[model samples]
Target: MKEKQVLIVGLGLIGASLALAIKKEHPNTRIIGLDVQKESEAFALKRGMIDEIAESLDLAAPEADVILLCSPVEAVKKQLQIISRIPLKESVILSDAGSTKSEIVDLAETLGLENFIGGHPMAGSHKSGVTAGDERLFENAYYIFTPGKPKDQKRIKALQSLLAGTQAKFVVMSTEEHDKITGLLSHLPHVIAAGLVNQSKAFNKEHPGAGRLAAGGFRDITRIASSDPVMWTDILLSNKETLLGLLDNWRGEMDQVSEWIAAENREAIFQFFYEAKETRNQMPIHKEGVIPAFHDLFIDVPDVPGVIAEVTGIIGKANLSLINLKILETREDIFGILQLTFKRKEDLERAKECIEKETDYLWYEK
Candidate 1:
């Protein structure tokens, strides 16, 4: 195989992480990076994502064997316009990290590009930017490849090899399928999260009393709404058509719940709740030999020194790793609750037994 020179056209988290994964996997291949923001370039360079940073793509386009455009969807579309007309090395295989692909694929076809591949990694955090770059972010994540037809098989093999460190299974999907499915699973969630936060705030303003009691649960659920609104707005707009379909489907379910409550159909409401619980229970277990599911185990402790310490000690002694913990310090709330995470049913049972045996703490949430 010929020695490779890879050019990463953006210095965001996705781009920098991809650079790091490629560097770790292919040390023989030199990586070049270009970003519009000077701070982003500096951060990516300091993090050692790219071996050298370029001032312009024009200066760096000629040498790359693989070129990754990891800019935003709109930005990627515009960059592809400029990139396709550039004096790129004829053998360079181009791939993109845009979340949306229909618009990008259209742009590529418009530019008459033959070796371009559309891609998305199914791992994104609420975090952003070059400073948020973590090499292991893509580890065990799914990477979807929407390769254009008539692509060189060698290029496909080379691109796949470059991403070997991601532990990402590269599944091939058409550009249209990728957009529609993602708009449902990925994009729709952001839309709903943001909308829920907005609707809650609007209701609070009208009711006024609800604002006084925005509890830990509401705060936790709405945390995704705190993510950059500009990014969410851009995604929602770019994937509007498919998102509308998802929104309508979600509304249909919401309408059923509303009708059941209005008619005082307790049986139907309880049945719906039961079905939801059952469906959630069957999810994949993150812990080996255990069912994958999210369950709430709430322990109440008095507001005193070492209360949190004493509670966690029982959990640790019982050998259960807490996945997430939050302490609420709001006034008028007497006891603090600890929501523990355990992979196995055995661990949950053990922790419950240990707490019941060793401590006088009250279990409030099941």
Candidate 2:
């Protein structure tokens, strides 16, 4: 097969990452990047992310077999406008990493770009810019494809083929479906997190020591509040209608909680929490939808010295590498649960065997 030329519009985290991933998997594939920031082009070039930096869209779009727009939601619209006016080859397949898909897909349709396939790789870090780009950023992540038309499968497949190096699981859905679900799953969460942080800030102003008391749960839930403010602001506004509906639903739920608290309905409150916990527990921790399933082992270990080291040593001797290790639970004079995360299921199975054979440790798959 002839090597496909991929043109990336923005050289930020996602764009630079796609470049590196493609370079790693398909070295012969030519990557052309275009960004407003000269430093980003230099950084990606220095890192061998792109074969060449297109000085302009005129230079890039015409030659590209695949065009990936990885800019902010608003900027994506502008880039689309620019690309629409450009005389490009009909074979060029355009995809985007925008958070909201409805507008982008509609814009592509309006621009008569039949080959444009809207995509969002559902993975990223709070960190931004080309410097934070990693080849494995999209590994085991969901790559959503919201095509402008149902029959644009060929173009979608070609775009996916170009992004094969990212190792993301492809999910096909309509643009409206993508927007509504993402509005709830992603955009609304950011809004809620920011609201919670603001509420905490206000409380801390009235009670100076309140800020110092935020630990574990508060910190975990609000971690996304530290995300790029400008980017999030654009996202929040872009998905305003769907987010507004979510806000109303959230308000209704909060009102129910308030009513329960006022009435002192202990059983009702307990039931509410019970149902929520049950539903949350049912959510898939390990990827099951095309993305590679995670191999995690949760072990209950005694809160004593040498026990963790002993377990780790046993696994180490078996030549199984742990991707992540976390003490899930710990308390005074109590057995703690340790969670071990691995990249491959075979490693997890090996670790399980080693644990059962070498020690009497109680463990279960996560």
lDDT of each: 0.77, 0.84
Q: 1-366, model 1: which lDDT tens digit per residue?
A: 777889999888789888888888878888899999998988777878888898688778877888899888878888888888788877779989888888887779789888788888766554688887767666556688887765456766878888997766677788889888878766777677778888888999789987756756786566556666665676778788888888899999999999999999999999999998999789654422101133456787677778778888878776676646666552344876667755345667778889999988877544
Best model per TM-score: 2
In candidate 2, list every pair of residues with a backbone clash.
none
Instruction: Give candidate 2's whole-model lDDT.
Output: 0.84
Worst 10 residues of 1 by lDDT: 286-295
For candidate 1, the TM-score is 0.80
For candidate 2, the C-alpha RMSD (Å) to the true structure equals 4.2
- Please give the TM-score that candidate 2 achieves against the real structure: 0.81
